[model samples]
Target: MIELRSQQGETVDLICRRAYGRETAENLAAVLDLNRGLAALGPVLPTGTLVRLPDPPADPPRVAVVRLWD
Candidate 1:
């Protein structure tokens, strides 16, 4: 688990992207679950608000790519 303070005009998505390099639905939900009442604060969190973030998944999901020209 990682805890970080919110910067001015920072949102959850931004935080997740900064911490984990990517923001996905799973991570967003996980972060919300970890920090209760965080969503109630609205989109832009107040500066200095404490947020708890879950650790990144050990193995990120892989997406299969399809070649348009083969």
Candidate 2:
């Protein structure tokens, strides 16, 4: 999970565009909504609200540029 700080109070779509550069923020929001389960709520990401990306699967990093602290 990344604690992304919004320099400007931008909407969720803008946030995703800035962070992930993917135009599927709405799909992510929908998934979040369904996972809410028992209680239903409004949009997950609201402007400057801090959110989490949940536990990412234990997959190898796309670009593992690990260098020893020489």
Candidate 3:
């Protein structure tokens, strides 16, 4: 687990992206789970708010691309 102080006007998604290089539903849920009542703070977290980050996946899953025409 990693701890980070929230920046001014920073949202959860932004934080996750900065720390983990990507934001996904799973990560978001995990973060929220780690920090209870974080979501209740609203979209913009108060500056200096403490946040816990989960360990990033070793290999981020790849998404399959759908081709409209080939």
Candidate 4:
């Protein structure tokens, strides 16, 4: 659970893009769900408002290759 305070004129979408990289519908929805009641306030969250961010997505798995000879 990541916590951040909203600056003046900052929206959840903007914050999510800046902090978490991409702001897809799923990501935005997750953040909205975590924060709760934030969507009711409309765009541009109030300053000093505590916003909770959900856990970031895990890194993609990597494939490893073993060669018999160098």
lDDT of 1 by residue, 1-70 (tens): 9999999999999999989988999999999999999999999999999999988889887889999998
TM-score for candidate 1, residues paired by index = 0.84
Where does candidate 3 have its weakest 10-residue lDDT segment? Answer: 54-63
Better of 1 and 2 by TM-score: 1
Candidates' lDDT values, in order?
Answer: 0.95, 0.48, 0.95, 0.84
Decide which is better by lDDT, 1 or 2.
1
Per-residue lDDT of 20-47 in model 2, one digit per residue for the tens?
6453645356435534531132434434
lDDT against true structure, model 4: 0.84
TM-score of each: 0.84, 0.40, 0.84, 0.77
Candidate 1 vs 4: which has more TM-score: 1
lDDT, candidate 3, 1-70, per-residue tens = 8899999999999999999888989999999999999999999999999999998888888889999999
For model 4, name the residue pairs that clash. Answer: none
Candidate 2 residue spans exceeding 4 A from truth: 25-27, 30-48, 54-70
- Judged by whole-model lDDT over C-alpha atoms, candidate 1 comes out at 0.95
Worst 10 residues of 4 by lDDT: 54-63
Give me the runs in candidate 3 sitting further than 4 Å from their true place.
63-70
lDDT of prediction 2 = 0.48
